[model samples]
Target: MDDSKEAESQLNEKLYETRMKFANLWESCNPVRFKQKYGESLKITRDRCIEIYEEEKQMCDKVEITKKNIAEQNALIKKMQEDLQIANQKFESNNKQKQEMLKKIKQLKEELAKKQELISTQKQENKAKLKELNTSAEMFKKRMGLEIRRVHGEQLQFIFKCINSKNPEQLFTFLLRFNEEGNYEVMSCDPPLECMPLLQEKLKETNNLSAFLANVRKAFAALV
Candidate 1:
């Protein structure tokens, strides 16, 4: 019975040792140990926050730079638009001037064409009058020895008719009055001696029949 009591005592001692080991293991899971392990996690979280802040600041700086660049580009575009507007206005002004000059040139061309037509008509009339004069001269030559005064009178009448075709009453009246007086009237006639100096000066400038016809037309229009 004493040996049995000795064995129970040994078992009780082993159970006491096992309980002490379990108690030590449970104490390792306390708040002091958990705080030591989680302190490093708090430091890691602080570093991550600083890194994110730095990244966000860089992004904001890039956005500001981009905004400034966009503003500069917009200013440049506005300046170019203004320059284009000014250039367009200048071009329009120049084109308007060119159009006005062209209009004036067209008017001058029309005037020149009218003057040429008047010159052509006068040429035809003068040519017909010259042919009539030549025919009358031939007729006068054929009757030179017979009725000289009558043929001379007819020639003078032919000359009167030729001048009357152009100057109508002006030249015909002067020629008829000169025939009656047998001498030219200086101050009293329609085309008096006063016109001779002006005609002499005009002939010095242009000795052509075209200029003479222009002068004759002007005189006739003035008489009208």
Candidate 2:
């Protein structure tokens, strides 16, 4: 009966030791104690995640601004192209107007030259006509002078013949000529007669050939 009590006591001591070990493991693995030990590391990780999110948002904003700038530049380029086209059209129109004005000026200059040439031609024609009229007048004056001299010569010859017929016994002959002054002059008489000297003097004073001939014929008839 004593041996049986010693074995039972030993078994109870072992069971107590096992229960104590389980209790120590449970205390070491508690959820609240683990959180307390690692809380600083978890907070550092969360802050790093917030920094990356902010960087990504800033990059997105910069990309949006760049897109807006590109769109504005394109609009400005289109407006400049339209303005250049308008300026080119204006230049072409101005050039065309200038050419038309130059053409008109050339035509006007040609017309003026033609008018000047026509006036010059008319002046030459008028000068020729005036010269022709002056020549004709000179010719008419010379012809009329010759005719008057011829008529006076014939009248003198007839008068001398009549006077010779009247004076049969005393035949009279005279010399007649034109002097330097284009007048008739009695040079001399063949026989000296009383009327011859007086006839020459009267002819010098009066310059009338017909009257002198008539007076000389009357004086010769009276002497006969």
lDDT of 2: 0.60
Name the best candidate (by TM-score).
Answer: 1
Model 1 scores a C-alpha lDDT of 0.56
Residue 180 shift from truth in candidate 2, angstroms? 52
lDDT of candidate 2 at residue 17, scale 0 to 100 = 81
Worst 10 residues of 2 by lDDT: 143-152
With candidate 1 superimposed using the best TM-score fit, by how many Å does residue 207's alpha carbon deviate from the native? 16
Rate residue 94 of model 1 by lDDT.
94
Q: How far is candidate 2 from the true structure (C-alpha RMSD, Å)?
A: 24.2
Q: Which stretches of candidate 1 lie above 4 Å from their native place?
A: 1-38, 125-224
TM-score of each: 0.43, 0.39
lDDT for every model?
A: 0.56, 0.60
